[model samples]
Target: MNHDNLLAPYAARSAASRGRKHEEPYKDSRPVFERDRDRIIHCAAFRRLEYKTQVFVNHEGDYYRTRLTHSLEVAQIGRGIARRLHLNEDLVEALALAHDLGHTPFGHTGEVVLNRLMADHGGFEHNRQSLRIVELLEERYPGFDGLNLAWETREGIIKHSSQYDHPGHPEDDDFEPHQRPTLEAQIIDLADEIAYNNHDIDDGLKAGYITLDELAALEIWQDMSALVSRKYPHLRGERQAYQTISHLIGHLIDDLVQTTTENLKAYHIDNLEAVRSHPDYLVRLSGETARKNKQLKAFLYRQLYRHYKVERMRIKAERFVTLLFTSYKENPTLLPRKLQQRFDEHGKERVICDYIAGMTDRSALDEYKRLYEPYERV
Candidate 1:
């Protein structure tokens, strides 16, 4: 109940200060929670997220999860988990909302290309890029550099235990040791998985890329159906799909709540921050659940991600991105003056490419078309 601890979860300092975003206004009209949320919502990165890919490309159908929609879903799911667990709601919302702010266009395809192109200039990692976006990229208040977000928010974005965990501590020279992510951060990662897993299947079905029969035929889907039916026997057919996935989401939330509650209970009574810091402290899913999640991930990769049609599209996207980077470097005049300034300061071709790669699909395409086809607008 300490006020400092209450605020501690959302505090973020700049490269200048070892603290959090201070929303000092003429008058204190909004809570720090509301202010932080609004700041993230209004930032250029947040807006750009709308045009970034979640799984599908921008040229794909509109119903797929763009980065913006995915963030919104993750935020909603995270907030739900936070409310049930009595954790800090604002911190969870902020974590979920800003988690993917630094993602490159064309989903992982663009990330792969950029990482190859910029391996020397500290490489292009989205988590690190996200940290940069909030800490330095966003342009707003004059006195501040970046958003000056809460340390917890930044930690959640960069250290949330996905494959994307960036280097954090000094033990590894190539990368930082990952920060010990909080329970709220853990929930956001699970929420992201849950949100995307179910929705991507839905989108695939809608796009005619995957048939409902194909989905049901998978052993994982069959088990998922069985689990849903065992849990809620009343649902069947279309109701099964809707109700089953809903049940899965609820089940995951329940697991997270129970597991996090146990950890919090231990944390409340113990002097062993060291023990609590272990990754096992936050992992909630059972062996069965873990297996199921893996199966689903594998199924998606084999069926949706590696489909020849989708792979061809992604290959083309990689070529387009490469072309843009090559052209931009050859003729730096095509870049904005601000970008030129960055180029002069960093003096690295890959760093410049990193900046461009972090753009949304539409922005990247626009930049490409602007330079290559000056007369025609994309």
Candidate 2:
């Protein structure tokens, strides 16, 4: 089927893509963005996400979401929204799946520490790191140093924004920092918020860091909880919590689609060019929904993210990242021979930052023990 034919006029079409950095002959029937998605899925960075942190460390519990599962959820939500809006599902899915490819081992804490450590050396941010991963880090292709993803996919990865992400960087000058990314990329941003906001609630409740009574105080949660109760009176316990979260996610998606459709009309965005030329995001939730979502986020920030236990982990993660980066900086020989070879080309700090940033939570911990522990095996 010609999937492009079904996409809205404003959606990003693979045929119109700016193309990859290192050109290759078309070797398959898959569209350009689809090929980018497949490449991301097979990359080492994506595989490492399986062991990377979301809100909890990998070993915290078997039930909590990891970066891999979070990315999957974001992709699922992004594709659903794209389908409803008649946008390019492939492009949205690509952006969603590859959004967090550059996250450090211990979630935001790791990123924070790394940024602090590299404050003099251009600083560190996941969005830029993600861009680097696709453009120059992952060495899968014999012809290129990185994945050589489609320009749209690379733009989405760099421009991906959320409360946690600050996307602009000096190295991203090639991506037109002044312009808005495609609507597909914009969709990934919100889809990412929806995934983490809702899933974090589930993880927080499961971990006993936040309770239902506290959540009931938030208007968004109360509204969803009431709806879930009315719809499924027999639901109780964790099942009820799950149902409420499910309903909340559905409500958010529905509101986003409706509001974004209204925005497209309001802003006169009828084509891909219009989307990019627009002054602000064409994809967004309604004002009321945004306010409610903000409230929910604030609640999570105070109740879940700031919980004593999570803070303790954050502190430890900071220490681990700081120590690791410092050790690698002081003793460049400690890095694997492969990483050491890149020191001449990429500089020592950046090469070390890249190596440490790519670590999974467990691997970072294991590496720390091997380097510092007297009896631990290297």
Candidate 3:
């Protein structure tokens, strides 16, 4: 039942100083996990979030939900859920904050295009890319390439997907599926859903892409506005919208926490440590709530995600990625020597594709323009 064992590795640094040396600063301060949260907050990738999309392109407006705002919202919601469930607030906040550090520009468009380009080279998954960003891309330390984050944080980053349901041993090829996430990671998944579900609506409305009436007409949405009013009677307009969502998220978190705690008790599961570490572990929902969630998911799919305008943009992104990937592979001279070295080692088009997947949206666009529309740039 002790919590220390679950958290000790994160508290200790991976490397120990050999020097006769420097004393640790600040006699007693926040734990290393807390420090990790702060580190992610200040990283360049975190800052670029402002320019990245979250359901809509950043160019759409100054007020829409960019990646930074979404991350903040997720962190806030995750922390709220964690505190209510008696989980570690810092761990949840850290995981929430770092969850999307590896997202490419232009949202999922960039992700899909990159994945297709790199499909042969182990393919590119955003979750894996996030891991690569923290572990290998960020060059802060001398001895190691990545931030050398704690095992718990790294595991959460890699395996936070809801599909995790495998054994929890190291030797497994897919350690993520087998490994159970800490309670923090569980909060993050729910928090991410809470954030995007509501925020995307906000963005769509602002962009003239959808309207309140249209949202209200959906069968699942009926009376929800009135429910929102009852839950947040004092707020108005956007504030009301935000509070209404916060209320729904709160209800879900309460239900989840209570159900999970009761389930553990009923089963006489004495693994308090395990239960506490994985507050967000997957659990079957009531058919009613499950159906409601699916309905909302469907509404999003039909109305927001599959609109013709979005499809056209996504198609353009696909073409841009494909064209550039093809050009770079045929004439490796166009790419930086560093990337070309990887191409040489792998000696496959897929290896070259992996190189392209790592580029930022702006970087990809620049490469595309450089190759396709040389005079247009002028």
Q: Please give the CA lDDT of all the candidate structures.
A: 0.70, 0.92, 0.65
Poorly placed runs, candidate 3 (over 4 Å)? 1-30, 162-176, 218-220, 231-243, 269-273, 276-287, 341-355, 376-378
Instruction: Assess candidate 1 and give its lDDT.
Output: 0.70
- Considering every candidate listed, which one attains the maximal TM-score? 2
The best candidate in terms of lDDT? 2
Work out how many backbone clashes candidate 3 has: 6
lDDT of 1 by residue, 138-180 (tens): 8897788778776656766676556444545332322224335
Instruction: By lDDT, rank the candidates, best first.
Output: 2, 1, 3
C-alpha lDDT (0 to 100) for residue 179 of candidate 2: 90
Angstrom error at residue 83, model 1? 1.7
Task: Please rank every candidate by TM-score, starting with the best.
Answer: 2, 1, 3
Task: State TM-scores per candidate.
Answer: 0.84, 0.98, 0.80
Q: What is the TM-score of candidate 3?
A: 0.80
Q: List the residue pairs that clash in candidate 3.
A: 135-146, 166-178, 183-277, 183-278, 183-279, 186-280
